[model samples]
Target chain A: MQIYRFEDKKPFMEKLEELLKSGFTSRQLEIYLPHPDHEIEELVEEYWPKSKLKFITLAGGLSGCSAGFAFTIFTSLDWPLITSGKPLVSIPPYIVIAFELTILFGALFSLGGFLLLSRLPSFKQIFHPEEYGNEFVIKILREET
Target chain B: MSHKDTGVVNQEVNAKSAAQVKDQMERDILAAIKKPKPVYWLGLLITITMTLIGAAAWAYQIKTGMGVAGIRNPVGWGVYITDFVFWVGIAHSGTLISAILFLFRARFRNRFNRSAEAMTVFAVMTAGLFPLIHLGRVWFFYWLFPYPTQRLLWVNFRSPLVWDVFAVSTYFTVSAIFWYIGLVPDIAILRRVRTGWQKLAYAFGSLGWKGTFKQWQHYNQIYKYLAALATPLVLSVHSVVSWDFAMGIIPGWHTTIFAPYFVAGAIFSGMAMVFTLVIPMRKFFRLEKYITVDDFEKAAKLLLFTGMIVGYAYIVEFCLAMYSGNPFERDQFIYRAVGDYAFTYWLMIACNVVTPLTLFVRKLRRNIKYLFIISFFVNIGMWLERFNIVVISLAHDFDPYAWGTYTPSIIEVAITVGSFGWFLTWFLLFSKTLPVLPITELKEEAE
Candidate 1:
């Protein structure tokens, strides 16, 4: 393989022109250099450009309310539950319990998904090591100056 | 004076280190599962056998009639009623941890939320069975509902049992839907990650999720809306549950305070149950890192706080009975301390009150074994609380002629055992079949 060297932008352009004239195409490809304008495009388009996001935070607000009401009703006394002159199945009071169970169940399900995805409690190997670090194959490509 | 290497942002190859960490975590999980001795299985088997015997007793009850149980005359409700109360309380902790904390934006919930939710669903299923089993002729149980039949009679929406029917039914439906919906993406991840039977099972559960952009968007929107709607329900369900007894005119039962008090106790007891299940779960599932000690600590502290609130309610009720100046009300309070059911009331006080206070010690709260011990005691206390509330009030009332002592027959105990077995069996199945965590969400959050 022949290496190309450039001392300045003029020489670099000349080398590129020579390569074009020589009808060069890259077959021994490893890594391609990035263009300057790509950064701007990425800034506008990427959903997560910096830190990798991990989980969806879920709060089961309404479901908790519904379940709480159900909990209240089931826990009450037998036969005619008319207390202190209130209606047997007081609608006004039951709302408190219905709400709690609803939210509770909702939050729980959310966690199940969150944990599985993160590979949590996965006390075994999931992925090979080389995939994460820049250890395998081409590390970097450089031009001589 | 200072030369810093700021240009080198990337670290040298850390492939080996990363691989080791990944492999270690995997190995640890496998080891965690393996560590639970065969004895645990033997215990489960014994429990199942006991449960089956209980089921046989239930078969006899079905054939002989509800009359076979001790309930009769003034004591139409006995052990079945107590069980209904107990199971409902057991079901409470999951929602209390998952929903209430979630609404408060507590991150501590993330650790054990999955297991807690599973417990809630199972507990509710067990709890729901009690009311139906209490009905002598389970076949005609549908008659309790208010529906238009050719005979032209409407159900008494006035019945607390009716409210209970609606409340528990709604809870089961909502909980079932919510639990399944939350598992969808996790199931898909499992489908992709697992092989053979696991892949097929996860695939079936995931219903062909492709991780499409559209799917994520829709899933997030629906989940958000459901959470908003479900938040209020957490309080509402338990409040309604309180009404089923608060509506009763019995001296102890008819108190207005029962609504909020019961709701608080439900949450308190429910939180304890979560600790009870979670301590073992993290160990069994190798979820120590995900469900950290911090979570266990927070939960234990919460159990203490609730236990105190419940204790306060107990004292307040006694004082209020005195203040009301009603001789009958005064006597009911006195009887609670020294009557046929006196042993139950005192035992309840010890279990629900004295025992849980032991958790006030920070060291005790942090210890998993101690937390497990205390959580179970909380459950016992809660169950007794329900027993005292229902049986004590019913067994003694305004008219001495109506006074009666009630004891649970063997049939009643059997059915309760069976219901618990059923719950445990379902959980066992779920553990084998599903990935208990949401992988996609974790990826997003962690990244």
Candidate 2:
């Protein structure tokens, strides 16, 4: 892995555009900035647009809702007792739990997906320039011949 | 120096080069984390002492039982529940500033969102303690959760208290994630800037963020959605909290307006707290350039808006009670204004409604001294408002024979004071550790 640091964004962008035009795969190059930039993100997205991130969040939320409903409804049935003279399978109140669980699992899945997709908690040292946090740096992984 | 003396508004925004902007932000914000003054330690010492006192009080209560807390059959929810509601209300503005303002693209929030979000987390932590303390059998607190037991026991899904458990816990989870996600880039900055133990800590906390466009893209996407998810919780959490009272059959507690009323009141109290905390912090941290009077004025406008909403809720509550001519509701409203606890009711009105009205004066809104003083009043008034709502309603219930006035015991008062100490300790520690200002976001705004 070769890391190049640029004091200005212009050189970084030019190098990025050159790398992209040369048909380098998105995985071969990583661009880091001091802060988020819309245009650069657009350029990155133009190359690597497909991501399965949302599916994890969606699946987690749906399952969370299902689990929440099952837990609340089944628990009442297990007891076979009524407190407020309402139906044993009271759906109105149970929806609160479902809603809460939906958010909880959705958030957890989204965070999990983010960590997994980003390959985070990365203990293995990669080529990261110290200036990358303040300035800009682009890292390119060389293909072994 | 007074912020006005700094002439922050006169500084030219467009004059600075990109490098200059970066340097200035780094110098100003990072100093708060790297340098500690004597005042910081003094404040920490005081808060720690208060927290210890509160813990001792809780210990005393546990040893003697709930009888030591002055709660009786009539006024069952006393200062502990009031403190719970007040702290929960104070937690609202953090989400409002971080999530709601981010959704609306309010640039002003960039300066103060980190501190506000931290307040939200700490305030919620403090608020969560009250329910446990109120539970005479503090050890039985886990029973609030729905877990299958040998007795086939389960929490009733029909209870608003159960809803509160889910709502508050989810709110905390989402808010904490939102807060931590926002910290990643800043933590990444600290990772490179610090050394030794601090470097290792930031290294782990930052999740190895590189400035890569790809990482930024994913971070931005996830953050946006988290903000989206948290927005509804800002409304729902407090609404569910209101239901804790609204679901009760007590005359004053059974109003349909409780949800919106409580939500508005929460935002109002929370904003006042933002003012209370930020005014002193900006001064102490010498962040006048970043957190200007203009920022305070904008927040004051919001404080005024929510304050008006709260004031309107109060009036509408009384009007509805009178118009309904339901003898029970009418009597309860009358009792609130003129009963034994009428001092608290009037105090709530004066602090929340009357004091906030002064902000309509442009001069007062911009004046730091006036704004700080008024915010202090609002904090006290909001606490009293919760006190009036919780205690007054229960005291003057439909059964006239059951009517009774109640006062908090010394233990309850100590715990209440301790809750502030606990909250302040976390906040003060946070200020010294994290960049109180969102350094990355502030730089983004500067550019």
State fnat for each of the candidate structures.
0.03, 0.46
Off by over 4 Å in 1: A1-145, B1-40, B438-445
Worst 10 contiguous positions by lDDT, candidate 2 chain B: B1-10
Taken over the whole model, the C-alpha lDDT of each candidate is: 0.62, 0.85
Docking outcome class, model 1: incorrect
User: lDDT tens digits, residues B285-357, model 2?
Assistant: 8887788787788899999999999999999999999998799999999988988888889999999999999
The window of 10 residues in a row where model 1 chain B has the poorest summed lDDT is B1-10
Model 1's DockQ score: 0.05
lDDT, candidate 1, B272-301, per-residue tens: 777766676677776765566656778878
Compute DockQ for each candidate against the true complex: 0.05, 0.50
Model 2 chain A weakest lDDT span, ten residues long: A124-133
* Best model per DockQ: 2
Model 2 residue B121 distance off true place after TM-score fit, in angstroms = 0.7
Off by over 4 Å in 2: A1-4, A125-131, A143-145, B1-17
